[model samples]
Target: MGGFFTPDPPPPSPPPPPVIVTDPEAEAAQARQDAIARNRRGLAGTIATSETGLLQPSQGVGKSLLGE
Candidate 1:
């Protein structure tokens, strides 16, 4: 068989290098501050509904039966 007709194997690739950071604590503190600011902007308060003006027809009968 001719060398030109034979298939050639591919070359090996180099491994990836590790990453090094200078300030890990500073990065964590900044992330916490961002989360707190986001939460404050989306916060909401609940409102209570009043029923003082609404009347029920059975209230008088129920009170008389119970001697209230």
Candidate 2:
């Protein structure tokens, strides 16, 4: 491969931009906000399907443990 001769190497590229650093406090606040929103959505769903609607729990006799 290098038996003959190789050309000069290319010039070095410029340095990359600065790295982005995240704030731990801000990250924690965002996580807490997201969790609160998720819990609110779940509560809304539970209220919609609560026993107050036509889907109330059955107060009938309990199932027998033995195969009577």
Candidate 3:
């Protein structure tokens, strides 16, 4: 009588790739660029509001629009 036999198991998967080390200088440069971009947007918005006189103080404490 013939006997049943099992096939060999598949090979193990390859290991994952190694992690890369980031450069501090490059990170700092990117942060600086981001900050500059953010500042530019803020400055533009401030300028637009100031031009429209929206940036003036809301309250006139002990003061008047015209000479007292």
**Who wins the lDDT comparison?**
3
Residue 53, candidate 3: Cα error in Å is: 19
The alpha-carbon root-mean-square deviation between model 2 and the true structure, to one decimal in Å, is: 8.2
Clashing pairs in 2: none
Worst 10 residues of 2 by lDDT: 45-54
Ranking the candidates on TM-score from highest down gives 3, 2, 1
lDDT of 2: 0.75
Model 3 alpha-carbon miss at residue 40, Å: 0.5
Q: Per-residue lDDT for 1-68 in model 3, tens only?
A: 33468666778999999999999999999999998888887755657556536556656566555687
lDDT of 3 at 10: 75
Candidate 1 least-lDDT 10 residues: 45-54
Q: Candidate 2 residues 1-68, lDDT tens each?
A: 33448866677898999999999999999999998888887745656555555366656656646775
Better of 1 and 3 by TM-score: 3
Query: lDDT at 42 for candidate 2?
Result: 76
Assess every candidate by TM-score: 0.35, 0.43, 0.46
- Tell me how many clashing residue pairs each candidate has: 0, 0, 0
Better of 1 and 3 by lDDT: 3
lDDT of each: 0.61, 0.75, 0.75
**Model 1, range 1-68, lDDT digits (tens) per residue?**
33787777666788788787769899999999998987785523121322332322445433454455
Q: Which pairs, if any, clash in model 1? A: none
